[model samples]
Each structure stands twice: as structure tokens, then as C-alpha cells.
Target: MKKTLPAYLGISFVWFSAHFGGGFASGRQIVAFFLNHQWTSLFMPAFSMLIMGLTFYFSMVIAAKFNTYDYSTWSKKVYGNLAPVMAPVFEIMFNALLVLVTAVAFATGGSTLAKAFGTPYMLNTVVLAAVIFVLTIYGADLVRKSATVVSLILIACIFIIYVPNIIYFFPKIIHNFAAVKSGEIVTGTQNSFLDTIWWAAKYGALQCCAIGAYIVHAQACPDKASLKKAAIVGFFINTVVMYLSYFGILAFVDQGVLKEAVPSLFVVMNGVGGAWMTVLISLCIVIGAVSTGVALVYGTTNRLANFFGRNMSEEERAAKRKIHCISSSAMLVIACWMVAQLGLIPLIGKGYGNIGWVSLLLLTVPILLRGLGLWRFAEDVPGKVAAE
Candidate 1:
């Protein structure tokens, strides 16, 4: 028998794609969470990713140990006897997060293309929704593969768009860095370092919710070591890309980049590249949004399918799983498109913050408390590896 090896790279890319989605790509999340806090922006993103990576590591290890790949089952194990009480609450929180992030992603793609090509926002949103719907129809394997492809393209585009701007605006970034340090350039409502730390924590909690997407793929990891490697790799990917984008956006702080609806597009329009860069970044944003939607939508669809098919036998459920997948995918996608109408900025700024706080209580805190105590026993079984 051929051994099924863990897909560390693929897992890392899935986490990365989910994190570097619409909000991060548009620079809205950075501005809202990190950059808005002024000088704290320099290191806060790294701090946030650290929190996220740790959470992901523990979550994956727990999933691998318990042979529970879905978030619902995984959460129940993590919660132990509290499963009966807390599991349903977690279910609600996870679904709410799915709705919010997926909606933001759709809004991001729609708004990005609308701004880039002067198209109708609704049409753009619907088109983006359709793309995600098709992508989510397949299953976890396809979601993983698509994430790898999208993440590579996004990484290249981010470097392409951000590197030039960072080069061209080096002096401005340096000046702003010093100004922020000296309390001369503060864009945030609160300039305290502790406040920035708090904000980073909140953002970390929100990002931690991506474990819903990742848990389904945890069975792909053959060992706890692979899970750790995936988290560390994911950490570096998120941190480096975040730092680059943060620096690039910082260059425009004095120019009021935060005031713009899409700070990244504003940066590109005002930075090293010209019209071509605009088109490229626009493409980058749309694809990033789609990648996020695909992973998240599939995660939710998986759970929904399991829920709706809970009473059926194995053979019957297998026959109806695809239909369940399609139905759930369509319901979630349509709901998200409607939510996207609330606009991108509001979704990132207002919606994300609230979700972060709630997630910290319902998701992040439970994982940390439970994972620390349970991880020592989470060794992989030799012949019991989950089938993909």
C-alpha cells in the first residue's frame, strides 16, 4: 500500500489564501486593525499572525489526534464534556463567521472590479458569486488545489505591485515610520501600544476562524509534526506578505491612504505602476476574494451536508452528498452576495471587529485552553489515518 503523505505545502497555502483574502488584499484589514494604530502597525501584524499560527497548530493537532476532520466534530472533541453545551454555540459562531467573511469577499471582488473597470457593482458581485459557487461544488481536495494556485498568483502579484511601490516610496515610508514613532503621525483613535496589542489580538481571533476551512483538510497531515510545520510555514507566509503590504501602505499614510475605501488600489494608482498595475492589482483582488470564498464556502458546505444528511445511511448520504453540497453552496453564496451589498469598508471595519470579539470567546479561547491540555495525547495512529 502506498503511504498517504501529509501535504504541508498545500495546507500552508490553504491557510494563507484564506487569510490573504479580500480584506487583506484590499488593505482594509491592515488599515482597520494594524495601520490605524500608527507605529504599532510595524510589528502588530507579525504579532497577530503569531497568535493565528499557534491557534492553527493546536487546532490541527487536535483534529489529527481525534480523527475528527470537520470543525463541528473537532470542536466537540476539543470541548470534551462541554460539547453538548458549547458545541452548538460554536456552530452558530462558525456559521456567522462564514457569512461575514464570505460576504466581505464577494463585496471585495465586486467592488474591486467595479472600481477597476467601471462596471456595475451588482453584476460584478453576481459574477464573483458564480465563480465561488462553481469552485465550492467540488470538495476539500479541489479547494486545497485551487488555493495553492491562487495563493501563488496572489503572492507574485503582491510582490509585483508592492515591491515597486515600496522602492519608489522608500523615503516616504522612512519618514512616516519616524513620524509615527515620535507621535507626529497617528491615524488611529487610540495611539497607545497596549491598544494596538489589543487590536492585534482581536484580528488574530478573527483569523483563527479560518481553522474551519483548515480542519477539513487536517486529515491530509500524516502527523503532528506536519501540522506544526504547516502552521509555521503558514505563519511566515502571512507575516512576510503582511509586512510587505503594511510597509507599502505605510508609505501613503501621510497622503491619507486610510481615508480611501480601497487603500491598496489607492496605493497602486498613486505609486510605481500605472494603468497596467491597476488592472493587475484588480485581478489580484478579485482572485483573492474568490479563493477566500471557495475555501470558506466549501468548509461550511461540508458541515451543512453532514447536518442535512445525518439521518441517511452511508450509501444514501454518499449519493446525496453532491446534491447537498450544491444546495448549501448556493444558499450560502446567495446570502453572501446580498450581504455584500452592505459594502466592503463596512464589512471589514465594523463587521470583522465584532466577529473577532465573539470568536475570541467562542473559538479562540476554547481551542487554546483545551489544546494545551490535550495535545500531549494527540499522536497519530499508524493504520488509522483518515482517508481524503
Candidate 2:
């Protein structure tokens, strides 16, 4: 069979699927980070996506260039001699992020479904966890494929729901902007430009760490050229969808929609009301959450499986992958459910910003420097000589 997708698009979809999770699809994270900043919400989302796109491009390039598919080996390539110490520290931090994001997915999925179906939140969460667990066990290839399919449906649903609202609410959007500019309304926590940008950058920083998940698929990226294509394709897909969702959510900010757990759903309920559209929006959120949960769970699973199977022969390791995957997925899903009790707002607000700061200090800065050639991995010496 000819492949269902070229390697580049597959990689791109993986990036999109992993990034557009509960926090994003719900529009709560955008409200928490961007819309609260009022007028800065206009461009800060695009800026934040740019930061993520560039960082993803750089990270994928390094991974492709070095041929380090898993985070364990990739960190070794990135950190050089410092790998002995820094790698384990980075692993702990990265796993914390995995847990945090996956937990948000569980929380977001459960809350949305429970509200829509009038079911128990815990029941909804258990079902959501089961779905993610099934997807995750199939491993990276299935995750990428599912991401592409789920993301396509999500994009269509978003356009159907959001475009109508943006058009209908044009007058309110303009009036709100004017109100913010005139100092008649201040939506942000701090009214300063620097503060808004800092928050936006934190959003970017949290996203940049998804490269840990992205690089596991790097082997599919035949070369740096393919990786670049994947990065650009993924970047545009993510940024465009985010902008659409942001504007739709922005139109309702003045209506106190930001106070809602799922602001995008509020936009659908009030702005684009049909019983079907409400269910559609709810479905969008849950699937998006599942897509993210699957990817993050699988990424962490790959790392753990690799560590435990280090002493095993290739045959032995391959045989054991399913076992490792099951254990890892179960452990992660349970942790995520427990953390989900903290609720959506608290996770996006208090939990994510800290991850972003830690990611910037530990992951993004070093990756940026190394990708720019400001620092060299000892592994690069032979490749550098070959080019000469």
C-alpha cells in the first residue's frame, strides 16, 4: 500500500494534534493568557504561535540532523557532556509537563462532555481516559494518523462554528476594541504591553516543549528538508485555527464569557446556537483532548519503555513494547485523572505558566542556542568536517 500520507504531512499532523488539546480547544487558555490582555489579544496569539513554530522548526531540525528519535537520545545529542546530569533533570521536568498537559486534557474532556450530556464528571473522565488509552496503545503511527483525522474534523467544526460568530459579532468586536483603547474597558490583569507579551511568551514556552513528542516521529522525516516542511505546515495549521478561535472567543469577552470554564463553548451556545452546534463544539473539544492525551501519553510511554528495555535485545524489546506501553499509559491516565480534580481554570492558569518558565530555562533556550550554532554538540564535529 502506498502510504496514507507523506512523511512530512504525517509529522505536521502529529504536531497539530499534540498541540491543540483541552486548554486550547476550550478557549480557556486563550482567555486566561490572551483575551484577558484586551487589545493585545489582537496579535499576541499570532506572536505566541510564531515563537512555538520557530522553536519547533529548530528542534525538529536538530532531531532530524542528529537522528535522535526519542527524548532520551535527543537530550544526549542536545546537551553533549552535560547529558550525564542534565538529561535526567530534563526528563523529570518534561515528564511533569506530560502529566500536566495530559491532566488538562482529561479535565477538559470530562467537564465538556459532562456539561453537554448532563452526566457525572467522573464517569465522563473515565470514559475519556479509556479512549485515550486505546489510542495510545497503538503507538506513534496510530497517534499521528488519528491526529490527522481528528484535526480535520476539528478544523471543519471550528470554521463552521467560529466564522459565523466572527461575522455576526463584528460590531461588538469593534466596539470592544475601541472600548479597550479608550481606557473604557480593561480586560487584562495588567494594562501594560510588556505584561501581555510576557504572558503570551509563556504560552509559547509551554508549547515549545512539545518537541519532545514531535521528535519521536523524526525518523519518518527523511531529511532536514522534510522536517522544515512539516514545521511550516504545522505552524500555519496551528496559527490559523488559533486565530479563528481567538477572534470568536474575543467577541464574547465583554459578555463575561471569560469566566466560563469553556469559553469557546459559550461562544457556540450564545453566538452560534443550534442544539447540533452545541454538541458539535462539545465533540470538537473532547476529540481534541483525546488527540493530545494520546500523543503525550505515548511520548512519555516511549521514553519509559526505552529506559527499561535498554538492556534487552532488539527482539526482546520489541516483544516487551506492548507491556511497557500498557503500564505507562495506565499510570499516566490515573495521574491525569487525579490532577484533573484541580479543574480546568486552575490547571491552565496556575499550572501552565510555571511549566512555560521551566521549559524556557531548561529546554527552549538551550535548543535555540544549539540550533543557531551558538553551541555545538560534540556529535556535530564529524558532520561539520564532512561538509567541508
User: Using lDDT as the measure, which candidate wins?
Assistant: 1
Per-residue lDDT value at 255 in model 2: 82
RMSD of each: 3.2, 2.5
Q: Candidate 2: where is the Cα deviation over 4 Å?
A: 341-348, 382-388
| Each model's lDDT | 0.83, 0.80
List, residue by residue over 136-169, the lDDT tens digit for candidate 2: 8877788778878887888898889999999999
Residue 213's lDDT in candidate 2: 82
In candidate 1 the C-alpha lDDT for residue 264 amounts to: 91
Query: Model 1, 275: alpha-carbon shift in Å?
Result: 1.5
Clash number for candidate 2: 1
Name the top TM-score candidate: 2
Look at candidate 1 and tell me the lDDT of residue 359.
82
Give every collision pair in model 1. Answer: none
Going through the candidates in the order shown, the clash numbers are 0, 1
Candidate 2 lDDT: 0.80
